[model samples]
Target: MDSNDGFDAATKMETPLKEYFDASTWARIHASLQGSLTKRGAGNEGTRQFLDLVLLKAESGIPWSDLPLSHSKIHNVYVRFCRWTDDGVWPPVLEAMSEAPEAQRLLEQLVRNHMIFRRSRKFRSEILKAS
Candidate 1:
């Protein structure tokens, strides 16, 4: 059993099994998620990448070997799959795109919609006016 092969790097460098989050399909999903989605353990882009792969598995079907180490590793996994159900550290860029002009229109058309609000409306308006 040579651990120094390339197995470690193979899964490490490669992205998730599915393509749930991409520019072409972000608006619909994000809005469906209610403006933004924060998975339980999802943190940074890597976690989101992993979750997207998990998502693909749920939608289509995944080969056991393709799952992450947490789901694949027979010994012990550093991160688990279910831990990140909905937290808040996923992708802001993708969320922002859901609110973009084009995407916003599409999102409104769909049942799900992104509700944008400002904590301080007056201040925000002033800032916008200044800019």
Candidate 2:
């Protein structure tokens, strides 16, 4: 096979969590999370790259240093990750992810397996009321 074939396959390979999120869902989450940022650097493109790095690290459970070198520098990625986390960007992103239809099956499975649990009656009641 041609060496280019390997490159093609690699480009087509989808990460697990990446396959779970559709484009519109990702865009919605990105839009919501982007607004929460207190400072902007690298513009919209930079924000997308940072979000991609965050998702990759979270899904793989890998250290930042292990991320693909094709992405932004580890220091830049790490700093942006910390800044976003501090700015409270993550909670809304997480909530959007949980509410996504593509994730509903996994969420149900987690609930079935008791991997996701309700700790307090009041909180449980609030969740149920919202739904």
Q: What tens digits encode model 2's per-residue C-alpha lDDT throughout 24-72?
A: 8767767666566646642465565555556666555676677664334
Lowest lDDT 10-mer window, candidate 2?
Answer: 110-119
Residue-pair clashes per prediction, in order, are 10, 0
Work out the TM-score per prediction.
0.31, 0.52
Question: In terms of TM-score, how similar is model 2 to the real structure?
Answer: 0.52
Residues 8-121, candidate 1: write the lDDT tens digits: 654544443545446655544444444333443223445445434544444444443555544445122223332222233224433554534543343232212111322356
State the displacement of the C-alpha of residue 41, model 2, in Å, after optimal TM-score superposition.
Answer: 5.3
Candidate 2 off by > 4 Å: 1-20, 41-43, 70-72, 99-131
In model 1, which runs have C-alpha deviations exceeding 4 angstroms?
A: 1-3, 8-18, 21-24, 34-51, 63-66, 71-131
